[model samples]
Structure formats: structure tokens, C-alpha cells
Target chain A: MFWSVTQSLLGGLLTTFQIFLFTLLFALPLGLILAFGSMTRFKPLRCLVQVLVWIIRGTPLMLQLIIIFYGPGLWLGHNIWSGNEAGRITATVVAFSINYACYFSVIFRGGIEGVPAGQREAGQVLGMTKSQIFFKVTLLQMVKRVVPPMSNEIITLVKDTSLARIIAAYELTFAGYSFMKSNGLTWPLFYTGVFYLLFVGILTLLFNHIERRLDYFR
Target chain B: MAILEVNDISKNFGSTTVLHKVSFSLEEGSALAIIGSSGSGKTTLLRCLNFLERPDNGSIVVRGETLFDASMPFKEQEKGLRTKRLHFGMVFQSFNLFPQYTALENVTLAEGLLAKEREDYKQNKKTICEQIEKHGRELLDQMGLADRMTHYPHQLSGGQQQRVAIARALALKPDILCFDEPTSALDPELTGEVLKVIRGLAEQRTTMIIVTHEMAFARDVSDKLIFMDDGVIVEQGDPKQVIDHPREERTRQFLTRYAQG
Candidate 1:
């Protein structure tokens, strides 16, 4: 009776939150680089990146999870992902990073290419160097353009972290379900929904505020 | 001696020969207009001066530095060409103002980049800001965009955006400024606004090379006018001669078609 729901759920929520932060850390910069590479003028380089993004986007995420978790040992005959919670978390991170990065790159590329070629020429006319043009001019506008779509992916990410359970990672969903099976506390699994809702709600409101700020673009 | 020297600059886009045996020069702080029908290689020649398009065969000497000297070889001359371009600024038919930035950021970003490379790199940020604000405020104000400083390009009117474009080019304080049909995108009403700004800049003795079809505008503003046709300079001289007393038959035909009463 003393096993209160708040404490039990809080532990699982902590794990869920960690995955969200870590995924963003690795994915944002990686996605931008991939976007730039895909837009490269060099034909072979563009083709290579396009094929990679296509395969990453076309395949199912769950399949990616299974492969990322299990493929290394089978393919290389070495268990690079050690047998522990660390390995499970590592595998989940890799799978999540790759899947989200591919999605993020498309948003990034669209934002950048949407910037008019005229703007770049204008920057050159002002004597801005290539890097200055990108960071100061192109990238700033790109962020505004990409935000709404990026927010969509981010909110989806809040839900996607639950997918980590497939690899036997003791993330929020796993912890909640464990209560259901062992103690027959079905309430805990349903309780997990509250955690997800709060996260998504907060992120959605944050994005809405950003959109309001960018309303000046109107 | 001419402050600028160009010898045999030629360019082709893949198979289409856009410019052939094109060459020109200018005196320091002199206003020269390159007037031509569309696709007559006028814009491309101006682009060569700015390194926006590398010429296939030519040598352009600005001040004393050789820019785009393809005669020496491509690889050896690329760096020198890019360096020379830092001394000149250009505006295009389209305003090309960065849609994401405010008017001030657009100007400051350029100075921050190109100025840092000069010997006076470690100068005070306050002075830099003062210079930018002084020129940027005056230009945008003169172009009638003082109220729209923080506005994005999309938020501004077409005429206002072109004013921002002019402000950006002037911010660089380059040795010369080039305009490629700068008013073509504007409505007749809006065209007057941008042209008026250019006229004011020209009155201040701002060195300029303009490519335009506005015959009166070109004739009135140009110290020298060049009529380029079929990728060659058909005629050029004082504006009164080229615009009024044309020497070449082609120049007369061109001027007559658009000559205003």
C-alpha cells in the first residue's frame, strides 16, 4: 500500500526524459550536416546522401531498432554493445539518433533551400563571406522556417521514446508495465500517459510561443 | 592610366557563348553605365568585375591587383580574383535582400567578415557600429525605409526591399558599386524610388557601373555609356554621344526603339 504511484512513476519518467534530451543533443547538428551534404553540388556526393536518407526514411523504425540492437553482434561476430543496461541504452540511442536524424535532415534541407538565392547574392554584395552568410543570414531564416516542422518531430519524439522498450530497455513504459505484470497494478501503465501528455503539452506550448515570436515574418 | 584594366575577358555557359572577346576599363571614382538588351552579356561583364562569374579568358586589374587573369592559368589566379572582389560591391535585378535578417544585421555581417581580414582588424566595436548605423541609417532613410529597419525582407514592400539591397551594397564602402538593371523588378512608381536613391548616390560621386534599359535614366546618370550588343561593345563614349549622337547603327536602332519623346 505504501508503494505510492507518484514515486514509482517518477523513476520511469526520469528515464523517459533522459532519452529525449540525449536524442536532441546528437541529432540536431548531425542532421544539419547531412542536410548540407545532400544539397551539395557534387553529383556523387549528393547521390550518396540521397540514397542513405531514402533508405533511412523508407524503412520502419521498429525494424531499425531491432537491427541496431542485434545486428552488430551477428555481423561483426563481436558484442560491441555490452550485455547490461548500458548496452541496451546505447543501442536505443543509436537507433533513435539515426531514425530521428534522417527525418530532421529533410526538414533542415527544406528550410535552407527555401531561402531565396537572391538573399545569398545580396549577402555577397554586402561583402559577407560564405560562413557569415550561412550563420548570420541563411541559417537564421532557416531556423524560423524549420521550427514548426521541427516542433512536430520533437513532439513525436516524446512519444517515440517508448519504443525503446522493444530492446528490453527499462525506460518509462517498461517500468510502468512491470508494475502491471508483477503487482497486477494496471493503473501504473495507464498512469504513464500523464507523463507523456505533460511533456507533449509543454513542448507544444513552447513551439506555439516560438511561432508567435516569428509572426514578425508575416 | 585607367583605375581599372580589363583585357580580353570571355565567358560561356556550357555550350552557349554568353560573352566573347569582351573587354572594358574604368577610371577610379568614375560612373560608367553598361547598357544592353537582355542576354547581351552586360550583366556577365559586370559579374566578372565582382568575381561572381569567373571569366574564361581575361585579365582585370583593379587598382594594381590582377583579378581573374585566366591568361596566367586558372588555379594560380583564383585566390587573387576572389581577393579583388572584396574591393567592389554589386546589386542585381532582383533586390536579393536576405529575407531572414533585419536591415542592420545584413549590413553589419558583411563588415564583420571582410573588415576583420584587413590590417585594422582589432578596431573598436563601438566605432564599427557607429559607422554602420550612420551609413545604414542614412541610406535606408534616403531610400525611404527608415521605419522598416527591423522588418524582414518578406515584410517589406518590393520597393522597400530594393532600398535595403542598395543599403547593403553601400555598407561595404567598396571602391565601386555595380547595378544590373536595378530597377527592372519594380513597378514604374516603385522604379522611381530605387532610381532616385541611385541618383542621390551618384550625385555624391559614388563610383557606379549600371546596366539598364531606362534610356533617360541611363543617359542622365551615366558619365560614360557603353552599348553592348551580341556580346560585343558596339559603341561607347560620353553619355550625350552614345545616347544622342550614336556612332554605331546598332546603337541607334537600340536607342530609337526605347527613345522617349
Candidate 2:
């Protein structure tokens, strides 16, 4: 029975990992784009992006997931998403990416701004074009600055994937919870905690390695 | 012919005028030093020469070409600002080297980026890169940083960082190199090394414009000196004459205060 429970939870962990990976793949670049949008010199675009980020960050991720998964069918009077496991997973990933991208953008903006203005001026006087300065000088420094805060958000993201269970997505937590409903067993729920700890432990090691590599400078 | 000419440059930030019709000219292979109290606009003038700051009303001409003209729209002036900036290399007081890059990478980065634009870059990539690396190393060696090329900025002393910055600036072979109080951030002990490098550059007839408070070094190393007060050049001429015999009351007052301080 213990072995069976472990196997079932492993299946759900796969789904959990997919959500985590897909969210990052979409959110990382989106966060940088949003960061640029928030920092744009043009007042209108900056204001618009700031408002969008504010709205996304002000609300709860769980609420966002529910609304995105169900709102399209409710408001439009037709289900835009197909009623299948893939559809539910897609909605969850979309909600998670948008939610995390906003948080990541704030971190990115802080990192970018924290680099001294003199660095950019040095690039300018070296005859570098603006984009060249951004990529070569500003971006590399920003990666160093953003790493600690970004690691925090990424670890938080790992735990937050459990929120997908709310919309009946059969992720790790849901798999652990299902045994209690069917077999009247609660130990598997405790087992799920171990999986999360191991996942977070691996992430901690990876972040430590990255932070060490970046230590070559600061 | 003057290698650089600044004709009536003025800059205003909102209602406060920072530079008031400042004018000066720099001859090729001659070093000019600008000495002033803080807020006297000496740094702004150097920045204007490097196109780091746009003058509200004036023109900057280098090598008989008008690089910036206030009569042109700001958009038009910006169009070629990057290329125009190549005419002058700048070193900041903070030694603003990219911390992530080693001294050698910092020195070669700009040249390597510019080389990518050459039509023959694809066919001659290896040779071009090797040439850039060789030049970068030579400049670093000239700055007395021969053994420290692989060290990151944070690993170097303030004086060493400034030397790397000088080497980085020289990597581009700019017509005029500008320094904005390059030694101001260094310790008194460290200032000598940086000054020695600048003095060597002067001896080699590398054209330079320096904004500094090192009055004695300015007097010895510069061909011409300018004394600025309240956004204008109060006195300028032979460095020895300007430092030893001031022609303006403000210049005298500033010198006396500097001497006392």
C-alpha cells in the first residue's frame, strides 16, 4: 500500500514539475519585457504597464487561477478552453505565469536600477549604442543583483504549484489528498510534504551553485 | 588646427543655469586641465565635450567636423551621437569599470563590439579579435597593469581600477581623452600612481582634458589651464601663468581657498 501510494504521488509530481517548468519558461522573458515596459521613458506606456503590474500583484494567485479558468466561459457564454485535463493544466500555467511575471518584474527593475548610472555613462563614452550598453554592461550586472531575490521567488513558486489542486488539477498535493478520500488514509498527505522538501532542497542547491558562479565578480 | 572647439556652450537644468556660454578650444596632442570648486561646472564642460550632456545652446566641433549643433533638432543630434562620442574617451572619478568583466575584457569590450560591424568581420573574425586583444594588453601594460589583466574591478585597488579605466579608454584610440576628477575617489597614497600614469600620457602627447583638484599636478602636466567659477571660465592660459598668477578675483579667491584647504 505504501509503495502504491508513492507511485501515485510520483505521477502527480510529474504534473507539478510541468507546471513549475512551463511557468518559468513563459514568465522569465515576460518578466524582463514587463520590466522594460515599466521603465520606459514614454509616460503613457510606462503608466499602462505599471497599472497592469499593480493589478496582477495586488490580487491573490489562487483567485487569479479560478477567474482565468472559469471566467471566459462565464462571461463570454461559451467555454473558450476545452473541458479536459490539458485545458485545466493550461489555464493553471497561464495564471501562474502572469502572476509570477509581475513579481519578477519588480525584482528585475530593482536590479537594473541599482546598477550605478556611471556604468551606463562609461558605456556611452566608450561609443556603445544604447542596446549594446544594455546587453553588455547593464544586463550582466542586473543578473548578479537579481539572483538572490529571484531565487526567493522561484522557491516560492515551487510551493505555490500546489494551488493548482484548487481547480481539480491532479498535481502532487491533489494526488496525496485523493488517498484520504478513497482509502481513509492521511499518512500519504505527510508523504507529500517530503516530496516538497526534496524539491525545494534541490532548488536550494542549484541556486547556491549559481550564486557561487556569480561570486567571481562581487 | 584645434582638435576640439567648443563655441558658446550653455546648459540649463530647469531654471538654474549650470553652464553659461562656456567656450574653449583644445589643440591636438596637448593636455588641458580645468580646475574649479565643486559645482563650478568644470565637470559639466568635460561632459559636454564627450557628448554625455547636451548643451542648450552651442556647438562642438572635432577635427573640423561639427559633431553637435544646438541649431539642429535634438532628434537629429541624437542620430549620430554614438559615433560622435567615439571622438572622446571618458574616465570617471568612480572608475566605473564593469565589475563583472575582468580588466582585459573591460578594455577590449568596446573595440570588439565595434569590430562586429566591419564588412570583413565574418571572414576575419579570429584575426580581428586577436588584434583587439593584443592592443588591449598593450594599453594595460602601458598603464602598468601588465600582470593584473585577468582581475575583476573589485579585486583591484582604486588606483589599479583607474589605470584599467585609462587603458579601457585608450583601447578606442580616441582623438581626445577626458578625465572627470579621476583621482578624486582615490586615497592620497593611491593618487600618485594614477597621476603618474596621466603624467606619462601627457609626456607621450596624448591629447587630454582633465577636470581635477590636483592643482600641482595640473600645473606640471597640462599645457593650458582653465579656472572656472559660477558656470564660466574666469581665466585660462598657460598652466604656469594661470596657477601662479591669476588674472581674475574669483580665480585668486578659489586658489587661496584651495591652498588653505
Best by lDDT: 2
TM-score of chain B of 2: 0.99
DockQ scores of all models, one per candidate: 0.48, 0.91
Best by TM-score: 2
Report the Cα lDDT for candidate 1: 0.81
**Residue A60 shift from truth in candidate 2, angstroms:** 1.3
Candidate 1 chain A least-lDDT 10 residues: A1-10
lDDT per residue (tens digit) for residues A55-157 in model 1: 9889988889999989988999997899897788778888888888889999999999998887776666565678877987788789889999999999988
| CAPRI level of candidate 1 | acceptable
lDDT of 2 by residue, A1-218 (tens): 99999999999999999999999999999999999999999999999989989899999999999999999999999977788878888999999999999999999999999999999999999989889999999998899899999999999999999999988999999999999999999999999999999999999999999899989996
True contacts kept of each: 0.52, 0.98
Q: How do the residues B1-261 of candidate 2 rate in per-residue lDDT, one tens digit apiece?
A: 999999999999899999999999999999999999999998888888888788999999999999999999878898878889999999999999999999999999999999999999999999999999999999999999999999999999999999999999999999999999999999999999999999999999999999999999999999999999889989999999988988888889999999999
Off by over 4 Å in 1: A1-3, A42-44, A75-78, A183-189, B80-82, B118-123, B138-156, B259-261
Tell me the whole-model lDDT of each prediction, alpha carbons only. 0.81, 0.94
